[model samples]
Target: MDNVEVPDYFICPISLQIMKDPVTAATGITYDRESIEHWLLMRHNTICPVTKQPLPRDSGLTPNHNLLRLIQSWRRSTGNSPGAAAQMDKRKTQETSLNQSHIDKLIRGIGNPDSQLKSLQKLEALAIENEPRRKQLVEFGVHNAALHFIMQCHRGKNTNASGLPEALHVLYLIRNSSNGLKLSQMEDVIGEIIEAFSWVLGCDGETLNKTHAIFAMKMVVRKAKSAQLRMLKPEFFQKLVDYVKQRGNKQGINAALQVMLDSSPWGRNRIMLVEAGAPFELIELELKSPEKKTTELILGILFHLCSCADGRAQFLSHAAGVAMVSRRILKVSPAADDRAMLILSLISKFSGTNGVLLEMLRVGAAAKLCLVIQSNRESHLKDKAREILRTHSNAWKASPECLNLPTLTSDDVC
Candidate 1:
């Protein structure tokens, strides 16, 4: 093996080692998949390493099957026999078993105060390391054990404990990995998980830990049944909105917005979030978020918030409320169009005042409604848009422009 000189073509450009899983980029350059993912996803590079061509963050990597087969053939021809390969594979399994044994010892020590933190640290490393180990951890019931550890932390109010941070981080990684089994309310641990998240969000901690806390709750809420979601208290909603207002990190904000959406199915959660100043934060986020998906999320949450009286009040209270909703109507995707219209419909039907009508007209809300009716839109959306326009036609007619605009009838709206 030492006498064999590896071909330069078999080496990864970035890693300078034999490629394990070679993947070709959009720029037609080959690289090791793990190395390229680290460069593009973790390091946040927008260009190919070798070609320097623009590579989208979400672009797929094509497996270099030909190169992989060639590498395998070369290895087999170079005195790498079946028996040797089998022995190497057996050794690898033994090594993995030894590693898992050490991890299991640490897991058992988690109950001991002196070594608990160190154990949790090792578990976190294993959980976060790579895909195979994560799957192994799941198979070993680490997720369940971590939940118990988290519950202990929650009950003890040891939010600042070193072990709890690692436990939360591990739980988050497990929740995200596709290989991990789904958690449910039937397990009777949902409440404990929520409490753990609340502690992390409300208490002071490292930014990374807090970020993981927000994402963990997001995953928890996304997976929880409607009954479990309804069981969440107002404080839960309040903390989520407060985290959004705090705007700790970009990923955390995204997770908070998603959690808000997930929890919005329960009517009380909507009001609680409104009370927590979610509408204001959402409006601010909408104004700031230029991404289509993020803007749609903000608008979707805003639509739910606007359904309730308190939510509508909070939404309208924002100076750019009507204007921002109006601005997104035709500019973004059709889904955005739907959400924006629903929000405007709520305000126009229940919260519309003369001043509000004039504000709508001045902010081009009236014009957007006209565009919705005139454009190729769904029948219901057109009806709502026309209803909005006709309901305020008399007041809007005060503006000469509104007077000259085609007068749409109730029948037309219907």
Candidate 2:
């Protein structure tokens, strides 16, 4: 890293102005960490200005002390456009009442560093002459601005809205686009949400994804909690998978997948996530864009499904699908034993009765399992494969044709 040249664009958005105390000109944003800290280590602050919520940070990047933070940092290496979320806090009644500092403090007070939320009763009392300020506070708030402020930095800051606007028009585009395009949007949203949760709210991705806020927006709704927000899920998921296929971007893919896994619970907003065409779609996609990791993910999903009696039955019931999957595993031959163990787990799920077990044997799956025990070098995998082998060994002992075949070892009685 010492030898690595830090590009000029790597300059902090706050520091581009060359101020000793650089601040986000557009969002009036500042972090507990700053530019130099960010340059030294990427971990600083990803907090939202209005919510005082710190954004979630991923383990993939290093920690920085002085950087403006990813929210301020990741907006661009060069920097944010600064106008989309920009607003005028102009005074009305033909005269201004307070200075910008007062206004900034008041707005920040809504999500004060300590605890900014004013009581609703207090808010109602304050609204006698200053109702517009309350509306202003709400508009400037990060929870309300989660999608808007984040998206505004990219576009539509100039678009009119007294408060957070419906972003479904853009979200619909994000949802309907191909897996590739939707992923790009998901990246932006993930980064923004991370920034919101970690920097603004100071929670990790694990917490944010699991929170009621996320669920309120994404899961558990007659029509997804927040329809626009819901549009992003499948797109985000599909994109992580796409990254693995197109670039072999292991680090990137894993980081993206981490977001999905964190966001694991079906927001219940839509079924597109857990039951989207993803698992089935992946089989075809992976054949062309095979990545060891994506294969592992697919295998993990199948393993999860196969673990339950009902799930296993359903998984096996899709005989055509199972056949395709078995062939895919064959294609991944010389695959790690862990992968073989994963396959063996799936195999173990099925009833080893004549039909299914014989079908597995006929499809060349049994031969493959036998080969796994004979050939695997990984100890953990080998041990599990041996356990599975014991199951098959019983079958071999029961059938004369298998009994006549080569023995696993001389110690075995014929």
Q: Global lDDT of each model?
A: 0.77, 0.39
Score residue 319 of candidate 2 by CA lDDT.
Answer: 50
The per-residue C-alpha lDDT of model 1 at residue 188 equals 78
TM-score (C-alpha) between model 1 and the true structure: 0.76
- State the lDDT of candidate 2 residue by residue for 1-414, as single tens digits: 222323333333323322233333223444223543342232123433234344444422333335534335545443433331121111132121334454445445433324332322122222222334334333333223234343442343332322212121112112211321213224435544433322211222222222222222231122222333445545445443344344433443444433443343334312343344334444454455556666665555544444445444554565544555555543564453355466555656565566666666556555555555566355665566556556666665455455434534423312
Pick the TM-score winner.
Answer: 1
lDDT tens digits by residue: candidate 1, 270-305: 878888889998888778765688788899999999
lDDT of 1 at 312: 94
Give the candidate number with the greatest lDDT.
Answer: 1
Question: Candidate 1: how large is its RMSD?
Answer: 8.6
- Give the distance in Å from residue 109's predicted Cα in candidate 1 to where it truly belongs: 2.3
Q: Spell out the clash pairs found in candidate 1.
A: none
